[model samples]
Target: MLNPLSLVSPPALRAALRDRLTFRAKLTAAFTALFFCAGAALLIFVTVLARQGTMEQFARITMDHTGGPTAPQPTSSTSLAPVSPPGPDRAASTPGPGPAASTEPWQKAEDARLARVEVNNRLQETAVRQMVVWSAVGLAVMAVLSGAMGWWLAGRALRPVRKVILAARRMSEENLHERLQLTGPQDELRELGDTYDTMLDRLERSFTSQRRFVANASHELRTPLAAQRTSIEVGLADPLPAHLIPVREDLLITNREAEHLIAALLLLARSDRGLDETEDTDLAELTRQAADELSSLAAERTVVTTVHTTPLSVNGDPVLLKHLASNLVRNAIQYNHPQGTVTVRIDDARRLTVTNTGPRIDPTRVDSLFEPFRRLDRDRTAVHGHGLGLSIVRSIATAHGGTVTAAPVPAGGLRIEVRLPTTR
Candidate 1:
């Protein structure tokens, strides 16, 4: 017959295990259970041994009380029975009765009963010992099974985490397009993967824009540089009449274009480095100064300019701020219709708005218009600029921790607002 203890199959036992219970926990629980069981067994064994020892001592005491084979004394001397002499020939021929024959029947019966009880007690103790040994063995087997099951469960529970780790490890700049496969409900790990993918998408877009900007800037710089070189080469190759000034004009144009490109590059570099020559200046005074400086250009365009002023103090580099304000005002006047109005307003709220009557800008392209080398007019005829004027304005405003926004006026033309944080 199969032992009941060994009837538990390994696979069936393993199937009963739970997940996330680690090996150490299982070990600790098993040892604790084993320690208690061992203690209980030891206690039972000691109690049984003690009871057996006590019973043995009691049996010896009873035997001593019975005075083994010793005869009882008379209560009084007259009551004693006189000894009878045996026949002389019979005494000589037969041996006297030994002490063993003098023992009482009850004494022997009690001794035999005690021996039988002792044998039965020994059998009971043997059965108890066997039970304790088997129980302990069963507990040890359970501990081993539990430890194996716990380790397997721990591994299974950590499987998802491991997959996430592997995915993260495989991620690189070259392979940022690769994404984690989220197959389950939106748990924390899945949420984390989603966020990571979102960030990577944004980074990829930024990188694409940066690459295009670099390519466009290089093309813009190359045009003027090539023109300057050609002008210099042509002027040196031939001596022209003094009044035939087309060459001089061409050289002048080339020089201006080169200077504009260099200046734009410098501004972009400085903006990137966070280099600003800052100081506290009156914005109203700055506006007046910019209007005066641009008066000649405005007159040439036949654009009437009006300046409304309020004292607004701000902390920033005066030259850069003037450049920013001048660019906006110039862009307005340059793009305005002949005999149109260009208005500059400075308010106590530290707001500067330059509004001009001009051709309306396409709403779709408004956001990209402020990017470097992005011209609103692709033909470059309606307006003359390095396409970096508004970009520089944005850069300088950002350096001063301000913002510049351009919006079309409800009535007509464009309204460019520069908002700065005021200083008391």
Candidate 2:
């Protein structure tokens, strides 16, 4: 058989013990239980005190009727007049009062005591019954109020959490710039909202950059493809020797441009995926090798090349490091004036500085030089470049956990620097 206590146990209490109760449910249950218990305890105290007071009042009333706290004066047992003793014959004739009459003298006192006790018992019972009714009413009302208050308080506490949930539900990549902008004290919830807002800010910038990059890439590719197609169409128009030679040359040039564009795109993509391998590498050696590899390109441009090196070891992907150095050197040579000097230096602090003599660069446009496909109007000609050299250098340097900075030299050139973390 189930215990009566088990039958009376609250379902919410059982759920809470099983860890299946909601926070609001637990809070309401706790409030009800607390109010009920307090009411029950108070009722019990009042009932006991009232019963005791009623009994005491009844005692005083009973005592007043029968004399004070001292015992009542003993009823006189002596008879007022003397009477002659009955003979044996008379005694036999008059039956002695049996047990009923032998204790008749104290009958009044016994009746009074019984009467007081009955009244006290009735009064105490009535008082306890009234207490029960009042207590039940009060506890029911208290439970209702406590539940309402508990729910309100719990909702207030969880408001921020609900806001966060709603904000997250509404979020998407396209709408990453939106922010919660929560306004309140700097509590944990507020801090969480701020952190989420900051993350969205970064995501918005990255997505924007990616979109712009893709659009520019498509435009760049289309330009060369359109040229190649036009060249082919014109060459096929007559199928003559004169048209064929020029067409072949135009096609080859366009194909070379397309190839270079594709290679640059692939390298950029690979760099975005980060380094594939890392090892101890000397920046000085990489710089020297890059300068040598570009010697012919430099010579063709009538640009003088000089290399200064200091052995600086760093941990990075060698191929990417080589690409970074080569790109920087190539950019210096390609953008320089004819007969200009290109200086490649690897300092003791693991910095690679490439300085070249070129046309004066606008200081405002220095930062944009690292952006892919971004070139000055003058450098957009066929013989100049695809405007990806500086961009590739920046990407490769970033992949190696390094930074690149550039500034226009006062004498009319660009001085670029790449700083890498040295291996201990």
Candidate 3:
């Protein structure tokens, strides 16, 4: 049976709703909570005091009506009860010897005062209940107003922070010169913007230095290589001595490999710097050309090649796009089994795929194939490639706002796919 707890979203378990709230929302909540607590405390204090005072006033008025704090006492002592002087008239007026006529007048007055005090208490209690209801209504209204005010204050305070975020997000290798230039007091937000600007300045300088170095290195290294290739081709000509034939062929092959390595390196660096201009290029044509260029290698490896196209096109640097296609096709062919099949295809949606029937590849380690110098275990110690092919392909694709992914095909082989934005 599935665990009920497992049905919960992973994110829900990792972060609560309150924790996921933005900084401004959290600050507003804090403000509203504080205001509510303070207001409630003040209202409760006043309600208690008012109730006590009202009750005390009711007691004082009750005492006044009763004449004194205690019942009145007789000033002089006399007979306990009035006895009529032995007269027949007194006996005739009194019906019986009952003590009803001898009752104290103050006792009746005290009972009437207690009834008035009870009525007053009921009125006071009613007033307190009404006061409590009104207090709750007032508190609720104030809470709403407080929440609105807190939200407004939070928005105002976060205005500069939002600006800083926008400025940072827009910062890229091509636009490293841009700055926040935030003008305000030397508070934390202002300090944050300033620090961000400083970091950009350093980044701008570093990128500039890196590009300069790449350019200088490219020119310096390519000049000597070109000169060497020219010397070898001219001095060694076509027909040569049998003893020197192998040496000449070796030199030419070595020179060609060096040139290829340098070209790949330059392509990687160029792609990293991003595209300066873009033009509509048909990816189908590039895919075909890549296959044709590597036809000799495939023939030597006894690999069969097939190309299919659907007229896919994208807006990007043609040279970089061509290199990306070439690298993918070359990697597939170079890492394939003898007499294997390499198929290339591009669709109208600007998706290019290359699948090869090569040696079985570990599915889990397929992703590492795109990293520089990372190769399958079968080719790990082989000197045929330095494994920069896929890395360059990825860099170029990213420069063109494209993506590349690779997966191991079941039953031994690999499949790679590249997707680029269609031309507008």
Candidate 4:
């Protein structure tokens, strides 16, 4: 058995109808039904009244023809005496079967019947007209009420969407912290709100990091610029006869610092944008060439270098890749111990590892080693360039969709691994 409550309720039916019909259409249908019913009832009432009137008129005419004095009368034959004519006074006093006499009772009865019928009919007609008018009026009132309700319901249903629109309109770059206060169960709108919030969070973090990087860059450049200015001012203001050589050397050092700063800045900017162009290049051949170029630098530090050759090919800017390999080998030789062995290994998988005997770095700071201006304590004395070698390496690797990692070896050295996607 179905529950009575499962039946379509009044509100449900009304809503379904409202969805299907427009306001004007519902009003038109209602008014048309009322008018048709009223017209039909009026027609029936008029027909009944006309029929009764015609019957009454027929009865009146029959009585008038039958009750005339010229009509024949029935006679009795048993009487012997002749009938005397009616005297004027007696005839005047007696009632004959004329129109007035024959029809008196019937006319009275018919008049009464007609009067009663007219009264009842008038009452009935009045009631029917009143009912139809009232019914139409009630329907009109209901239509007005329903219109008001529908408007209210439409407004309520769109309230949440309105709120979302307002929230979205208020968002901007400066006010990215603002978010929609959506209070509902999981839905498309809620999911949209969540995604929007997540995007804003990421953007905020990126902007914050960018701002910090700019500030740090400004500070780093200002130091070298100030030193250069001081050196120039001192050289111009006082040319001491005895300290002329030292002053020139100090100026040279300041100029070198400025040049280093500029180079580091350019490298960082290029890495951020990506390599200008890419071409097919042999990684192993490039590494061997860089090792040969850096052999003199390594020999001065007494670092014994060994290079393993393999045909490791990749698609990239050859110039940048050469610079990347040189930086890695140079850092290794510059930071290694006296007479330490520096090994460069290249495999068929385009994996290159550079290991050098050097003071081990703290594991916690290994990740930060690739950051610009970061340098290990052992390389502090090695000068003439900014601490951006590993930073450039990481950047080039990223541009080529590769990665680099540094770890302390068990044999008391640093092992740097460079992994590149092999061109198959």
In the order shown, what is each candidate's alpha-carbon RMSD? Answer: 18.8, 18.7, 5.3, 19.5
TM-score of each: 0.46, 0.48, 0.80, 0.47
lDDT of every predicted structure (CA atoms) = 0.72, 0.78, 0.84, 0.73
Question: Model 2: which residue pairs collide?
Answer: none
Assess candidate 3 and give its TM-score to the true structure.
Answer: 0.80
Pick by lDDT: 2 or 4, better one: 2
State the lDDT of candidate 4 residue by residue for 114-172, as single tens digits: 66556656665676577656756765666566556655664555456666678677654
Candidate 3 — worst ten consecutive residues by lDDT sum? 70-79
Output the lDDT of residue 18, model 4: 86
Candidate 1 local lDDT, 151-246, one digit each (tens)? 566566555666767867865433556776666777876777677778778876775666457556756776767777776768655476766567
Model 3 bad stretches (over 4 Å): 1-15, 73-104, 167-171, 229-252, 359-368, 376-383, 410-413
Model 4 CA deviation exceeding 4 Å by range = 1-242, 376-385
Segments of candidate 1 deviating more than 4 angstroms: 1-239, 242-244, 275-277, 378-381
Cα deviation of 164 in candidate 2 (Å)? 15
What tens digits encode model 2's per-residue C-alpha lDDT throughout 272-345?
65676789988789889989989999899899999999998889888888888888898888888789999988
**Alpha-carbon deviation at 223 in model 1, angstroms:** 16
